[model samples]
Target: MISLVSLLVAAALVCLQSGYQAYAQIEGKNDLRDNLQPNIIPMPKKRALRPFINIAGPPPESARLIPGTLLELSCEVIGFPAPTAQWLKNGEPLTEFDDVNEIMNIHPTSLARLTSKMIVSSAANGDVYTCVATSGVKQQMASTTVVTVAGNDEESLFGLEALFRKPSKPIITEYYNEVFQEIGTSILLPCKHFSTSPSQVYWFDGDEKPVFGNPRMRILPTGDLLIPSLHWDDMGNYSCTVKNAYGKDTVETFLYPNKKQFFLVTVN
Candidate 1:
């Protein structure tokens, strides 16, 4: 050894150089992520998810009605998953075999549907009518006419014509000519049927087009028209057309400003 101090100094210098080499080895980047690209996350699509369970429907615009009359209940609904349907009357559930109840059909895709006529008879004359449908997560509801008993027998009853008659027709057993208001007051036209065929009846306004009653205008089971309120336009020559396999018949009436007879009123 040249000298003990000289030997120690040489060892110290070697250690320092080794440490420097290790530091210099990481010259380009100290982190591995420096050369890597950032990752991007994809977003979800903006479409309505399938199997949506939601009720879709509206209650009937009217409820009060006469016994033996037919009331219609309808609704439209969309479901992610299809749902089963159930009908109810007076809170009691209904099935296919339920008497006096029928289902027309569900839509082609089965998203919407209609209920058959809820015939209001003496049994249901004063009972409430309702329809309810249930799906996996959705429920829909609709209502039927109110059962009102007419003050008169002629205006309180409704009957269907025989469906098997070769020539079908609707027959009126009673006729009442009453003038309740001025030119605008609507009149009730009661229609009855006694035949062997399905009696298809049509009501025409003054000009022969189908005449549908407004909320203020009501058609009773006995085929009587009820005007909740009258208007000048309600005055006209109203007509009732009945058709069946046997034959067809038409009835006409002239309503004026007052109870004035058809020929008695002076036309302007």
Candidate 2:
């Protein structure tokens, strides 16, 4: 009986060892198969390119034109994913009006070219024009040009050329000479002018740097400088220059901050 019990215990131990070895063999095969399999990693997507403007053939410079003559203003721009163009007169979008026509031509390509044209029956003096090009992901770019219309001299009884030869100087309005405002306020510096032909308006800082086409600073349709938010650093001398075919005039103004009055308080 003792021999039979020992034999049974040995047999059970052998069976357990064989089962464990078989399980180990199966696990090893699974690990080997996993290691032999190919790994698939997803690729990253390509990014789209942003658009930009070209330097060539942007827009014509300031033109001295005659009244009742055909005026053609053209602008060309290039960018990726195509770009749209718009025309603005004195900071306002221009539309087709009586005696005025606007045309836009777009060429599709990898790098697209957009052209805008504006034809006026009779160009007037003091008309500020700009062409703005915009894309989906890029900042808008613009080009500005000023037009001066040639005025006819009534006293000249000779030829038509002599009547339209004289050019007039710019005359800036007097109301915008001095401006006073508190901090964090807004102000508009009027720079309106009168000329026999169209004139261009420009703004300069105290450091004589040109100021226009900024988010905070803009030239209004009436040739006024619009400063949306005035800070303490904005207190300085500013000048507005208006130029025409004949001559240009500059008017300077000083911006002053309003004084803050302080009152004494007694301790309670």
TM-score of each: 0.33, 0.37
| Candidate 2 structure quality by residue, lDDT tens digits, 70-103 | 4566665555434555667777776643112222
Which stretch of 10 consecutive residues in model 2 shows the poorest summed lDDT? 98-107
**Model 2 misplaced stretches (Cα beyond 4 Å):** 1-165, 259-268
> TM-score winner among the candidates?
2
Q: What are the root-mean-square deviations of the candidates from the true structure over C-alphas?
A: 32.1, 28.3
What local lDDT score does residue 85 receive in model 2, on the 0 to 100 scale?
59
**Clash number for candidate 2:** 7
Query: Candidate 1, residues 211-239: lDDT per residue as tens digits?
Result: 57545555555454555444656667676
Q: lDDT (CA) for every model shown? A: 0.43, 0.54
How many Å off is the CA of 187 in candidate 1? 48
lDDT of 2: 0.54
